[model samples]
Each structure stands twice: as structure tokens, then as C-alpha cells.
Target chain A: MSAFNESFRFGIRNIRKRPYRSFCLVLAAVIGSYALFVGLALKASLNNGIGRMQERMGADLMIVPESSEIEARNILLTGEPEFFYMDVAVATAAAEIEGVECATSQFYFTSLSSDCCSTRVQLIAFDPDTDFVIGPWIDERVTSDVSNGSVIIGSEVTPLSNGKVKFYGNEYSVAGKLGETATGLDHSVFMSRDTMHGILNDAKDKGYQFLNPEDDGAWVSTVLLRVSDDADITAVEKEIYNRAGGIRFIETDKLISDVAVKLGSVENIINVTLTVLLVFSFLTMILFFSVIFHERKKEFAVLRILGTSSRRICFFSLTEGITIGAAGGIIGLVLGILTVFPFNHYIENSLDVPYLMPSVAAVILYGMIGVLVTTLFGSLSSFLSTLSLAHAETYYTMRTGE
Target chain B: MAFLEAQKLVKEYNRRGKTFRAVDDIDFTIEPGDFVMIEGESGSGKTTFLNLLTGLTDPTSGAVIIDGRSLKETGDKEISKIRNQKIKYIPQGESLLSALTVRENILFPFTIGGLERPSEERLLEVSDKLGITDLLDEYPSDLSGGEMRRATIARAVINKPSLIIADEPTGSLDSANTFKVMEIFRDIASEGTAVIVVTHQKETLGYATRVLEMDQGSLKEVV
Candidate 1:
């Protein structure tokens, strides 16, 4: 065991003896590991982003005013609030359709330029009794109802220090805050039908002319639909289109699935690039060690003359490889994290896709796996490089004439 | 019985379908405290002979017996142990490990032998004897040829092995360093270890108790 200690010490000294050669070996590992980590991290974040986007969209089909498809998509995708209205009678017609599970109406309101609001916010109102999305989340986070004078805010919304917010010059209780969905929903707030109408009345009293659902023939902005389990969503969407003229049926599920397919192609390209880098770096490390061992043949021969076994010599090589791999792996992981965390917004915007970091558990598990695999590669490289010495005859090795 | 003996030891090699003897059937013996010098021309097989005797290479036929144990009968690991604990080989030119400092190189035998490191006092004694005490911290690249040769000798003797085999130990040294190294070997042999030196230097014969000549893969004692 002490012999092993001495050999390990000698292995470290060997690496220190040739700085440039050692650096080249370590850098090969670093580049491979860095590429792998960054690719995996981005893939994980994109996957998570896809999930959140799907959850934030929470509707099987959305009915919007005719010729407002682009405007509706822009509002949901970018959170740049817009109000385009269709008659409230659209909800009653959709709910009466066969295979329609339930239908809910929502009013879109923006407070960016309204003097009655304390700050800019996208305020969306749903019928508390008929809503499917946002209601359950509010129930889980807070016990109170989103009734006459209270509102549920998304994670990105800010309330006063005392948990109150002023909208339309009226003070409302901030009932709860939503969890992050990594989507535009995070920047929007929810209110019940009566509370939203009361805010609209206050704004109207202040001389605002936004459409009012209570006015006969006035329109609500959107009607969300939940299709029955037994019904094909496409069939129901077609039925809704036939029965309800002057409204566009947007299947939110199809939107998510389409974006998912496009993101998968980007992921494939990254995977291919990562595979090439891994192979190149792995081969480079093997070649580096092979040449180093060949150059050190005479040094190893001298050790054998001093009665050191070939096994010990091979062990020295293995130690050097593992050391280089571990050091390189740690450096690579840190670099990957630093590059991703601070510049994630840039990556997401460049790719025109949503991206969220993976959970802490996933990051740790993946990081460990990366380090372990690279270390094993390093060990295998050393083993292949030193196979000749492991089986060499001491006489021939010594006679090689160093 | 001799302290170390070779009974008709032979080593042969095949090259391009022809077999030739590197060390032909030869019998030799030396007692503890003996200082033996072997002189030969290039390719005369003096180095091969030393390799055979020390178990560095397997004999094609016949066998070597050290302290009554046949080297041919021992396993590879056992042979390595025998080599580590009983024999030390110092090869020609630049044998010191370049990565290790002089002191670490001298302590290397114990490391390979799996023995506890020798105390610094004993190490200083050996280094002082070889006049390398002041050069312990220096790496092999920093040492002169004579200093490296002396350091190699210190490494070989640090384990206090029963047999010391050196192949052209002073081949790269100046006359002053060569004479000084031979004197160190002479003193080591006086301490009761059998010392065998293979060299072409006629001046080295002065330190030997017995001198042998190698001609055509065979050994004959002259003095």
C-alpha cells in the first residue's frame, strides 16, 4: 500500500514534469465534458419549458373573435395585453354543443395606462363557478374565495406590503400568488366575474369606454372549452366552428404539440454536435496518453530495472489519467453552469423558445453522471495506452536504449 | 555451496527464423563479500549474462539458484520479490528517474520492494558514503553524470540487498568520478554483499577481488 502511495506521488510528479503535455490531455477531457454538460442542461431546460408552456395554456380549445387569431396568439405568447371582444352568447352556444365538457368566459383588461390602477398589469377575469384553470391553483394556495373584493396574482405580480393591491382606484385583497409556469401566465392576474365587472364599472365611472359584458349585445374577449374524454378534440372543434360563426377555434393542445415538434428538431441538432465533440475529445485523450507513454518508455524501463513491477508502472499511468479527468470534469461543470445560468435569457430569446432550468435534483444527478463517465473514459484511455508496458519484457524494454 | 550460483545458465533468442545464444550454457558462483568484475566487448553477452543471473530475463535452459532456491521454479511474482529483496540492478546511462528528486530516487527500491522506508539517518549514511548528501533534493536533470551514477549506486544499496549487479555503472563519468564510484562499490562489497560489475573499463579491475573475461557468450576467469 505504501508502495502504491509512492507510485501515486510519482504519477503526480510525472504530470507536473510536463506541463504542456498534461494540459493538452486535460483540455481534451474538459472540452468533451463541457459540451456534454451544456447540451444536456439546455435539453433539460427546454423540456421543462415545454411542460410549463403546456400547463400555462390549460385549455383544449379557445374561441376568439373572428379575424383575431393573430392578436389572440400574440396576447398569450407575449403577454402584450389586448382586448378583442366577441358576444357573451358565444359561451352559451359552445357549452350547448355535443361533447363539450364545459365552457368558461374571460375578459381581458390592461391597466398600463389606466389611472385607476396602481401599476401596469394584465388583469384576466373568469367566472369563479365555471372556471377550470387557475381556480384549482388558487384553492391549493389560499383558502379564501376569489369573490367580490379579492384577486389571485401570478408569481410575477407584486402586491402591496400588506397583501393588498389597488386596481381601478379600488383596494382589493391579494388572495394568493401562483407558482411559476415560465410563461406569460406568470405575468397575469386572475379575478372572479363579479369582481372584474365591478372594476370595469369603476373604470367606466372614470370615463373609460372598454366593452362591458352586462351591456346587451356587448362581447367577452375569449371563451375556453374543455372537451369531453370520449370526444375527438378535432371533431368538437369542427362542430364549434359550424355552429358558432364569426369565431375562430384555436386548439391549445395542438399549439403546444406543434411547438414541441419544432423544439425537438433543435434538440436533435444539439445532440449531434455533442456526440461529435464527445467522440473527438475521447479520441484525442487516448492519442495523447498513447504518445506520452511511448515517450516515457525509457523512464518506465528504468523503474523496472530498480525492481518495480510492470503492474506498478501501469498503475502510475492510471492514476495520472483519473486525476486529469476528475479535474477537467469539475471545471467543465462549473463552466457549463456559469454560462447557462446568467445568460439563459439570451439563449431563450435567440432560439425563440421558452427555457427553464431543470430542478435541483436533476442538475445534481446529471452532473454526477457526467463526471463519472468522463473519469471512466480517462481510466480506459490510460489502460489502452499502457497495455504494451503491462505485458512487456523488462530486458527488451531496457535494451530499447534510452 | 556458493551464496549465489548459476548452473549452466543459458538464454537464446530467435530472429527471422534463426536461433542464437545470447548467453550460452555457463556455470558461475560467487560467495558473500566477493567483488567480481566482468569484462567484454560489445555484443559479447556480459549484460545478458547479468540479466540472466538476476532473473531480469528467463533462461532458455538450465537455472539460477540464489541461497539454494531455484529462480526457474519460482512464480513471476515470487521472482519479482526475490529480485526486489535480494538483488539490485543498476543499468547503464541515465537510470535515475527523471521525475523524482535524488533522495526519492534513492528511496525507490524500498517502495518497489514494499518495505518500510529507511530512516533518514540511514539514508544520510548511504548518501554520505556516495558523496551525494548535498544533492539529495536535486532532480536527475540537475545532476552531473557522475552525480547521477553515484545516486544510482545509493539507490541500489539503500535496500541492503544480498547481491548488487551493475552494467557499466561508470560508463558516462570522468576518470575522477569513475575511480570514486569504483571505490564506493569496493567499500560496499567489503560490507559483505556480493557485487558483480559488467564493464569494458580496464581501470575498474583494480577494485575487484576476481576478474572474468567474456568472449562469444562464455565466461572465463583470468585473475
Candidate 2:
């Protein structure tokens, strides 16, 4: 062990002697690993954020769409045909099934109101007293009217003293904004049932109704029903069809398949890219160590003449490489991950997403893996260099006498 | 038994298919405390002869026995053990690891040879003996040729090996530093370690108890 320390000191001394070479080797490892680390971190954060949203989709029951071509989240966010106003009359009858609970109806809309907002604004409506499904989603905004003058806005809703938005060239006050849904719901404005009716009716008079809400006559998107908590949802779904009428019942969650596919695609690309980067890093380390040994050929030979064994010299050589690699990996991991906090803002704003901060244990685990793998790669490269050259002879050195 | 012995030591080098015999049938021995100077013109196989005794290069035929083990028969590992435990070789100019501080350079052989750990007391002892005590913190590049040589000598003796081999140990020094280095070697040999020096200067003969002159790979008593 003491012999090892001595040689390690010697190794470090040699590296310090050539400051340029040492700087270059460490710099290459840091930049490459940092790039890879940052990419992987962003991808993981996205996956985690999507997972939470999917759970909100109601994990067990499959969401069935009236049509399968469009995205489910899009349907939930804006009642597209894919999300049928599921025959609102079916809700009252569907609740009478043996295992069924009370059922309620809701309407999701992506419409431009005379409310000055240029981006599409999301809106939803539920019977203020009866809609148990939207209960958890409702905020602390206390108002008695689910009518023309009452609105529960999303977190990003701009507030004003008077209710007026110049959408379709008229005025409306954003009654309130809901807590951030991490869904684009931040840009959404909710209206009392009467307010939504007024807006839609006005559109119809203007011959500007894009969706035929009268298809169901009292148009509502998917209905949410409370089942006996213990009752199997799949069985209840079947019973509802048999007892009431043949209708497709979907669990809220099955709608997130698009997010899942998006996540998977991103993961695949990142993994492939990471694998290539790791290989390149290995090669870079190998090239760096080889050049180091080449330059210090004389010094190593001198050590051998002083009586160091081949195995000892090789061990000493690898130790130096690993030290540098480990340092670079840690520095890269820390610098690469600091963006998580900054990303908190981005996800909140643009992705309409929120992510739990990575825990201390998690970040530590990631750092450990990063440093270990990097060091192993460096060590392997140093070992390969050792294998190709005889550690003892300093043959070239003795010949040139340099 | 001689403290160090090399009998009919033959070393050959193969270049493309032709084998060049560098050390040809050289028979030599040194008793304990003997200061034997081996002199030769350049290319007379003087360096090869040092390499043979030091086990840096192996002889193709014959044997070198140091402290009773044959350099030819023992594995390279065991040869190193003998070299580090019994003999120390100081190669020509540029002998030290230039990057290490003077004390570190002096301790290099001690540590690499697996001889002993260094303590401040021992470091100061060796440094003071070679008159390089104040230079312990300085690097080889900062020193004159004489200082480097003295530092190398301090390192060679730190392990206190049974034999000291100086190959052109005084090459870069003036007559003053050269004699200063020779005086240290003579003092070390007086303390019972055999010292072998390879040099061309006749003035260096004063420090040697015995001298063998090498001419084209052969040795004989001179002066």
C-alpha cells in the first residue's frame, strides 16, 4: 500500500508537470459528461412529470374515446370529437346500475371569448353542487353563482376589478383562477354554467359556433360517476352497459396514452445518445492516458530501473486516470443538475408541467453511478494502454537515451 | 564469497536478425567496502556493464551473483529485490525525476525500491550528509548539476543498500563539485557498502580503493 502511495504521488507529479495535458484531459471529460448528464436529467424530469399527470387520469380504468385518432389529453383539455359529449342523458340512467354511483356531466372547451387572450383558452363547467368529479379540481374561490356573473379562473388567469374581456369584441371579468394544474389549465378560465351558455349562445347567433353543442342537445363531455369504491370498475363498466344501455364508459386515466408514447420516444432517443456518448468518453479517456504514458515513457522506465514491478506500475497508472475521471464526473453532475431549479419555472410556464425535486438520495445515487462508470471507463483505457506496451523495458527510452 | 560477483557475464542485443554481444565473457567481483571504478571510453559497453549488475538489462549468457543470487536464473522480480536491497545505480546526468522536489527525488528510489518509508529525521540526516539539506524543498530543475547529483547520491544511500553504483555521477560538475561528490562516495564506501564508479577522469581514481579499466567490453586492473 505504501508502495502504491509512492507511485501515485509520482503519477500525480508527472501529471502536474504537464499542466496543459492534464487540463485538456480533465476538460474533455467534464464537457462530455456534463452534456450527457444534462440531457438525461431533462428527460427524467419530463417522464416523472407525465407520470403524475397520468395518475390524475385515474390509473385503473381505461379511458375510451368516441373516436381514437386524436390525443386524449387534448380531448380532456378541449372537448374534441374524440371526447364525445357522451350523451348527457345517459348519465342519469347509467347511475342506476347495481354497482354504480351518482353520475355527473361536464363540458371541456377551447374557445376564444371576447376575453382579449390570443392563445386558446380552456374552459370547463360542472353543476356547482352535484359534480363530485370536479370537486378535487375546484379551488377555494367561494361564490354562490354557477351563473353568468361567476367564474373560477386558473392560476394564470389575469384578474381585474371589473369583469370584462374583449374576446369576440365584448367584455367579461375573469371571476377567478384555479390552482395550477401543471396542465395548461393555468391559461384556462372557468365560467359558471350560465356564463358558458351565454357565450355559446352568442356564438351561435353570430353564426360562429365551431362545434355543434346541440348534438346531445344539453351538451356535456364525458360523465364522471362515483362507483362503489370496492366495486371493480371493469365489472361496473360492463354492468352499466347491460343495465342502462350499450355505452362505452372510460376511466379518466386511459386518456394519457399520448403522453406515455411521447415519453417513451424521448427516452429511446436519449438512451441511444447516452450509450454513444459513454463509448466516446471511454475512447477519449483511452487516447488521453495513452498519450500520457507515451510522454512519461522515460519516467516509467526510470521507475522500473529503480525496482518497481509491472503490476505495481500499472496499478499506479490506473489510479491516476480514475482520480481525474472521478473529479470530472462529480463536477459535471453538480453543474449539470443545477438547472433543475431553473427548469421549475419552465415546466410551470411552458410545458404546463410540474416536477417534484429529485431527492437527496436520488441525486447522490445518480452522482455515484456517474462517477463510478466514468472511473471504470478511465481505468479500462489505462489498462488497455498498459497491455499494449511493456511496463518494464522503457525500451524506446533506452534506445533513444532521451 | 564476494559481496558482488559477475562471472563471464555475456549480454547480447538482437537488431533485425544480427545479435550484437555487448558484454563479452566479463568476469568481475567486488569485496565488501570496495570502491571499484570501471573506466571505459563511450560505447565500450560500460553502460551495458552497469545495466547487467543493476538488472535493468539481462545478460544472454553467464551469470551475475549479488549477495549470493544469480541475476541470470532469478526472475526479473527477484533481480529487482537484490538490486534494491544490495545495490543502487546512479545513472548519468538527468538522473533524478526532474519534476519532484529535491527531497522527493532523493526519496524516489527508497520508495520505488520498497526499501523503507521516509521520516523527516531520516530525510534531514541524508540531506545534511550530502550537504543538500537546504535544497530539500527545491525541484531538480532549480538545481545545478552538482546539486542534482548530490541529491541523487543522498537518495542512493537513504536506503543504505550494500553497494553504490555511480555511472558518470560527476559528468556535469566542475572539478570542485566532482571531487565533492567523489568524497561523499568515498565516505559511504568507508562505511562498508561496496561502491562502484564508472568514470573517465584520472583524478577520480583517488577515491577508488580499486580500479578496473574497460576497453571494448573487457576489464583489467589499471593504476
Candidate 3:
């Protein structure tokens, strides 16, 4: 057999001979690699969620009724279905404010969980002429404008076999489907004001009135505003609060920065934890291998007397380390996948933040990196102990016989 | 020419800031087919002299030459290669690796030296000569003391080294096994390989062509 094969066989036999020691080393690597995989996957998922949120919320400032501010934020972040209305005049006044580049209004409605709808979901109606937020998204998916009798579905919503969805005794044709935004928006449906009005009239015919008795259909839930490029966001926010009275102004940048701060705290915790785990694993491996080599000093001395070079002894030691590390790392990654992916929704809910898993390719890359680092640490730890043992005086070591 | 030579060899040790000699200025030579035995009292440095001869320890002030090259001028890797290829040192007690079978332990020298494995017939022949052919597949733990000793001797000769240096090879064996091991060494030396045995057992002197004694860190020939 080849030299490498011989060395490898010898190393494997040694590992089998000392199963308890090898297990301890492998356990160290497993803990380190598991932490690495889970921590990196979570960090990437939160960052992806934040990026998606920033991109999807195209409005610079959103003006909602003061009482519905928290509700609106929850709807945007969590996709919880809610409905509130203010005067349609809020959109007109906000549009007339200085530094306001454009203004559009969205009407919010929640469908009942009964048979009249496919599922309980948020229905958001946008004004086609002035919309800047949902319009671009619609244009990307559909070949033409969404007609009055058609609706655009979010990624999570399921349409019927006929490509239609029912709400409050009315069925609308499905126009197109939007990609995942990893926010409450993924569970929302988008339509034109005309389609929304038709739904409301149909609801009213069933004696379910969503708007105030005096308002008829002249109501809007929130007005989305895009400020001019050179305008200060804070200034625009104040102007909107002043011009559109009895409203709460939500600055998109502030909202994003707040989430980013939360994300930073989570990342710091993960970094500190990963650092602690890796350091602990590395030191434990060094200590274990040191003790193990010391106990086997006689064995090494015998090899030396049998004409084995110190370098070859070291190589054999490292091969054993690599085998232990690789086995542990692969097992840890498999466990990480099982723990992180299957409970991703639970993790997001418990954290109460935006959490979107990264792409498959990114996940695979992270796994590879984790295994490489684990193997490096394992081999490096063995090198320190083996170097001294390999170069020790063979006569003294054999005579001492630890 | 001498198959192995040591010139003006000296070995010293420092204990608690005081220096003492283990082997002092000992010059020795052995030719092919020579079975030389050195008898010494405990702590008389017979093992240290053997260590120096095998290049396992560097002399304090002199040199050991194997075949033609001086050990002092040999690099560590080259010395290891020489040890693997040309010399085999069988230390006292159980030296078989516990992790390998008797067969693997015997073949370890060839494997580590990157030499092609000896044919199965040669392996069986060596083991059969050492009376360990039946124990080839057993681990060291499963072998008795005498069986383990024979396995070590088998490993030492498997590489066909020019010289064999055994330190107290029968230190822990019964009389029957001890005489059996000594007869094997006598047979090996008769085939033109030089042999050196260090022992306190006077009975083993019967197999030696030349006998020496070590006393107070020095050697003197015995008639």
C-alpha cells in the first residue's frame, strides 16, 4: 500500500482504539460548527428581510390616522389584517404640501374567514393614477393594467382553479402574482380603487358596512408620500403632520433605521456567541490532544525508533484531526439545517422581526466555510502537541513509558 | 571494513547542575556475521552505549559511523532513512503498537520507510522463524509476554537490516522462550548480519562470538 494509505489506516486504527478521546475531539468540532452555521444563517436571513423591507416600502412617509399608527405598522411588518379609514381629503392635502413630489392613497379592508373568501387576508386598494408604491410591482408582473374586475395576489395567497378569488359575495379574476417580499405584504392582495369600491358596495348589499354611514365611498385609510430628492425627510415629515392634521406621519427611513438597530443588536449577540464557541472549542481540542499525545508518548517514541520521521508522524496526527473535524462538521451542518429551516417561521415570530432566509447558493457557501474553518482548527490543535512529541528524544520517552 | 564503528564515543548527563558520563570515550567495531554481547550491571550504561550505536542518541563528543557515513554529519531525515533501511533497534519490553495486529506491527518498518511490503511468503517465513506465525492476526493485547517479544523480534528483522541491536531482549521471558530467542539471533548472525545484544543474563553469552563487559561507564573485552 501507499504511504498515505498506510498512515491513514494507522490513524484510523488509533482513533478506533481510543474511541472516548476521539469522541471528545469530534464533539468540540460539532459544537463550534453548529454555532457557526446557525449564527451565520440567522444573520443572513435578517439582513435579507431588512433589504426586502427597505425596497418594498417605496414611500418616504406614510400618513395614517393617529389611532391607527400602530396597526398600520403591524400590518406592514407582520401582514396582520386590519382596516381603518380617514377622509379622502387627507391625500389631497398631503399632495399639496411643500416638498411632496407625489401622493397616493390606499384603502384597507379585511375579508371574513367564511366561505365568501378563499382565506382571511388583507385587501389593499391603490389609486391607479397616482400610485408609485404598488404600481411598479404590478407592471413588472402583468402584461397590462389590472382591470376593474381583476386582482393581483401576493405570493402567499392561493387562487382558485379558475384563477379567481372571492371576497364578500364577489369573485374577482386573478390578474397576476407578486414575488415574495418577506413582510406582511406577501399575504396582502392589491387592486384598483374601482375594484375595492365594487367589493364595498357588494358588502353593503349584504348589510355589512365597512365605512361610516355619512362617508359613502369617499374614504382612504392611508396616504403614501414621496418627497423630493433634495428635500430633508424630517422636514417633509413635519410638513405632512402639519398639513394633514389628525394624522400620524411615519418616515420610512426612521422605520428602517429602527429595524436596522434591532438587527445590529442581534448580530452583535450572534458574533459574541460564535466567537466564544469557536475559542472554547479550539482550546478544548488543544488540551485534549495534548493530554492524549502525552499519554501516547511511548507509542510515538516507538514509531521514531522504527524509522518514522517527525514530519511523517505529524502528518499522521493531522490526518486523524481532519477526519474527526470533517465528520463533526458535516453532522453539525445537517443538524443546523434541520433546526433552522423547519422552524424558520417560529424563529421569525419569536424574534418579532423581519426574517427571510437567504438563497440556496448562499446557504451552501456558508456551510462550506463552516466545515473548512472547523477542519483548520482541528488540525492546528493537533499540530502543537504532535510537534513536541515527534521531536522528543526517543530513548528517554521509551524508557519513561508514560 | 567494519560493518559498524564507533570512535571516541562519549555520552554525558546533567543532573541538578552536575555532569556525569554515561559512556566515556568508548571505541568499538563489529564486522558482518558477528554476534557480540555486552554484559553489564544495572545503571552501568549498556543501554546508553546501545543507543549511541543506533544513532538514537547523539554522542557528547565523538561520532558513530554506519557502513561508511558518519552519523554526526547525517541530517535527521537521512538518519531516520538509514535506521529504517540499514539498522533495527529492538528495545526491551513490549514495543508492538497496541493498535495494530501482529502482522501490521511487524510490517510497520517497511510501511513507514515507504518500501514495498514484503511478500506474504516472506512475512510467514519471518514469523515462522520467530515462532509467531500463528499470532500474526492477533493484536498485541491478545498475545502473551513471550509471544509479544517474539513479535517485536519479527518486526526488527522484517526489513532485512544489516545490523540488529537488542537491549535486554529476554528481560521478561521464561528460560525456554529466552533460549529460543537467543537461538534465533544466533541463526540471524550466521547469515552475515551483525548482531549486538545487551543483557545481564550470563546464559546468553553462549551465543556470542565476542563478549564484553560494561562497568562504571566503561567497557573491557572478556576472554
Candidate 4:
């Protein structure tokens, strides 16, 4: 252990000895970790915020006419291959299954999207007035009487000119814009069930007809179904799968799991990101230890002569890497949160997409994994490099002072 | 048996289709408290022979026996402990870690071996004796050649080993620091510690009780 401490002391001193190379090494690590942390944080934040927003869907199951779970998962994960909805009948039938409670359906209309338009008008939708789950969820975002012809605008989606407007051509007022949900809800416009139906019927050609309406009528895009109070969620999910038949039953667990898999699985884009970050991390560590390795060759040779085992050298290298990695992980974690919050706020403002930091467990776990991986990488590389020399005669290595 | 002994030591290397004998078969010994000097020109295999004696290198044939253990029989770690507890080596050129303060550099050997030299009295005694008491905070990069040599010597002696080994410890110093380093050696030898220095400077012979010169990788006594 003293030998380990000595090697670490030597490692730090060597860094001081070659300030330029050490600076470049640490700078590379900080910046590389920064990029990785920010990417991870932003990805996680969006997933979390949208996840929180989707909680308003208020059920353990999401019913869609399209059974493409992978595409649905991807869309939920990274906003790819945008929203897919099913006929409103899917919701009404879903409520008849065992262990099921009330199921509600809603219609969504993509609002005016542009930089010049001030009145946020995205995801303008209608919810069934008698529904318990989906209707109440939107209630949080809408915060209006919602009974009359009045329309509730999101913080972003305002009137056509940021001025007041009649609700769905009804004689109702705009009521008022509501507080932010920090999600896509920021740009959503909410109106009464009757008013929303009228607008969707007018834009019915592209809106509700986006899904097959031939055998489907009184159609809606999303169905939020709640389980009975005494029913098990997992069992209810299975019941959902059995009853939905042709429709896609998205078990919320599978929903979140799919997102995680796509973000980090080995062959996916997350895999490409993983490869890039690993290479970058490896190169950063190698450059760091290599420079320190050259400076400390004599010290190591001397230690070997003084009796330090090769394993000891290897272990010391591991410890040194761990030390630096732990520091970087912690700093990177805090920096990641601080970095994402402001940018996320700006995203909510400019893009009207809400983002927030991931859960604490995710933040800590991701950081810890990152540190462990980099430590193993840096230590193994430097250790193998140092121990390769430990085999040759220690005396000769230090004799000519090369 | 001598305090330190080498028997029929041989070191050879084949380079460019030709064999170069770094050290031919040689036998020698050092008694306790001896002030011995091994003087030779550059590339005379003086270091090669010294390395074998110190167990820093393996001899092609023959053996180095220090105290009671054989270098070949003992493991590298045991050999290091033996060297650390019984002998101190001063390499050619500046031997201090460039980033450490003079005091920290002096305390390096003990620290590497995990021994403590408290700052209360032991440190003061050594620092005061070596005239480095005032320069404890300065790094080797800032020290003069003479001061670096002194600081290294202080580090070497901190363990109070039975033998002090110097490889051209005076080569880089001015006349004053060279003489100063030599006087420090004499003082260490006076305390019953064996002092063996490797140098090509004939002028340093004045301080040696006995001088051995290497010719064509062979040692001949000239005292």
C-alpha cells in the first residue's frame, strides 16, 4: 500500500514535471467527460420529463392500433417517427377487460409550428368529459373550468397572434394561459370535448384519418386505462395484452425498459455513442499515463530494485486511475446537472420541449459506471505497459538510464 | 568471509555479430567500515561490476553474496529489502526526484520503504549536519549541483545503512561541492559505515583510504 501511495505520489509529481502534457491530458478528460455527461444528462432529462408528463396518460397501458412496439418505444424514447394513435373504440373496449377500470380517449392536433408564431398551438387536443384518468391528467396542464366552450392554451401555444381567440369557433373565451409543465405540454392547446371534436372533424382528412378510419369511428389517438383498485398492475398489463388483440398494448414497464435499451444497447446508435466515448476515454487515459509513465520509468525501476512487485505496480496504476476517475465522475456529475438545467430551460422556451435531469439513481449509477470503466481501462493499459518492463532485468533497465 | 563479496563475476553481451565482455571473471570483497574507491574511465565496466555486486543486474556466471545471502538465491523483493536495510546507492548525475522539496527528497528512501523519520529531532539532526536545514523546502530543480549531491547523500544516509554507494557523486559538482561531498563521505565512513564511490576523477583519490582502478573491465588495486 505504501508502494501504491509512492507510485501515486510519483504519478502526481510527474504530472507536475510535464505541465503541458498533463494539462492536455486532464483537459481532454474533463472535456470528454463533459461531452459524455451532458449527452447522458440531456437524454436522461428529456426521458424523465416526458416520462413525468406521460404519467398524465395515467395508466399502466397505452393502446395503439399499430402493433410496432419497437417504433413506439423509439418514438417514446427519442422523439423519432412521431406520434401514432388508434381509434377511440380501442379505449371503450379496453375498459371491459378484467381488472380494468375506466379507460379514456383523447384527440391531438399538431398546432401552428414556427418561430414567428407566438401563440403556442401544439398538441391541441380534446379529452372525454366523463373520463377519470386522461381527463384529470390534462386537468393539471389545463387548470381551467374546461366545461364550457372556453379553450386553455399552454404557456407556449397562445392565440393565433398571441391575442385572444374564440374556442373552437364557439362563443367561449380563451380563459387564460396556464403554468409550464416543462414538457411538450408547454406548446399544447387544450379545449372542451365538443370544441376539440369539431376541429378534428374539420382537419379530419389528415388528423384522425392518419390512422385507418374505415373500420374505426369515433376514433381517438391515445387511450389511458386505469386498473381496478385491488387489481395487480402486472396482471392488468397481461390482461391488456390479451384483450387488445390487434392493437398495441404498451406495458409501462416495457415502455421505460425499451427506452433504456435503445439508449445504451450495443448495436444501436447509443452503441455508436458508447464506442466513440470509450475510444475517447481510452485515448485520454493512455495519453495521460503514457506521459507519466515516461517520467516515472526511473522511479519504477528504482522501486523494482527496492522490491516492489509487478502486481504492486499494476495495482498502483489501478488505484491512480480510480482516483482520477472518481474525481472526474463527481465533478462531471454536478457539472452535468448544472449544465443541463439552463439549456433545458432554453429548450422549453425555444423548442417548447421540456427536459429535466434524470433520477438521482440514474445520475449516480451512470457516473459510477463511467468511473469504473475508465479506471479499468486506464489502469489495465498502464499496468500492462509498466509490467511488460517489470519482466526484463531491473538492473539493466536503470543502468544506462535510458 | 568479507562483509560483501563477489566471486568470478562475468557479464557479456553479443551486439552486431560480435561479443562484448562488459566484465570478465572477477573476485573481490569489501570488509566492514572500508572506504573503497573504484576508479575507471567511461565504458570500463565499472558500473557493470558494481551492478552485479549490488544485485541490480544478474551476472552471466558467478555470484554476489552480501552479508550472508546470495543475490541469485534471494528473490528481487528480498534483495531490495537487503539493499534498503544494509546499503544505499547514489546513481550518476542528479538522483533526486525533481518535483520534491529538498527535505522531502531526503526523506524519499524511508518513505519508499515505509519508514518514518519524524520532524521533531531526527530530521533536524540530519538537516543540521548536512547544511540543508535551510533548503528543506526547495526542490532539486532549484538546487545547485553541490546542494543536490548533499541532499541525495542525506537521503541515502537517512536509513543508516551499513554501506554507502556513490556513482560519480562528485562529477557534476564544482571543486568546492566536490570537496564538500567527499568530506561528507569521510564523515560517514568515520561513523563505521562502509563507503564505496565510483569515479574517474583522479583528484578524488586523496580522500580514499584505498583506490581500485578498472582496466579493460578488470580491477587492479592502486592504493
Best candidate (score: TM-score)? 3
Candidate 4 lDDT, tens digit per residue, B36-100?
99998898988778777877778899898888778899886677777666788877666676767
What are the per-residue Cα lDDT tens digits for candidate 2 across A48-157? 55655554443233222345324445544332222244555566656666666566666665555444433356666667666664455564554344466556766656
State the lDDT at A160 in candidate 1: 69
Docking category for candidate 1? medium
> What docking grade applies to model 3?
medium
DockQ of 2: 0.35
Which fraction of the native contacts appears in each prediction?
A: 0.58, 0.39, 0.69, 0.41
For residues B127-151, write the lDDT of model 3, one tens digit per residue: 8877889899999999998889889
lDDT of 3 by residue, A242-358 (tens): 766788888888888988898899889889999999898889888998898888888988888888888888998998888878877887788889978999888887776778899
Candidate 3 segments exceeding 4 Å error = A112-116, A158-173, A201-209, A212-216
lDDT of 4 by residue, A230-275 (tens): 9887777666667565676677666555534543342245346756
Off by over 4 Å in 2: A1-15, A46-105, A109-123, A126-217, A221-265, A344-362, A386-390, A394-401, B72-78, B112-131
User: What does the lDDT read for residue A210 in candidate 1?
Assistant: 76
Better of 3 and 4 by lDDT: 3
Highest-lDDT candidate: 3
In order of listing, the candidates' clash counts read: 0, 16, 1, 10
Q: Can you give the lDDT of residue B84 in candidate 3?
A: 88
Question: Which residue pairs does candidate 1 place in steric collision?
Answer: none
Winner on lDDT between 1 and 2 is: 1
Q: Which scores higher on lDDT, 2 or 4? A: 2
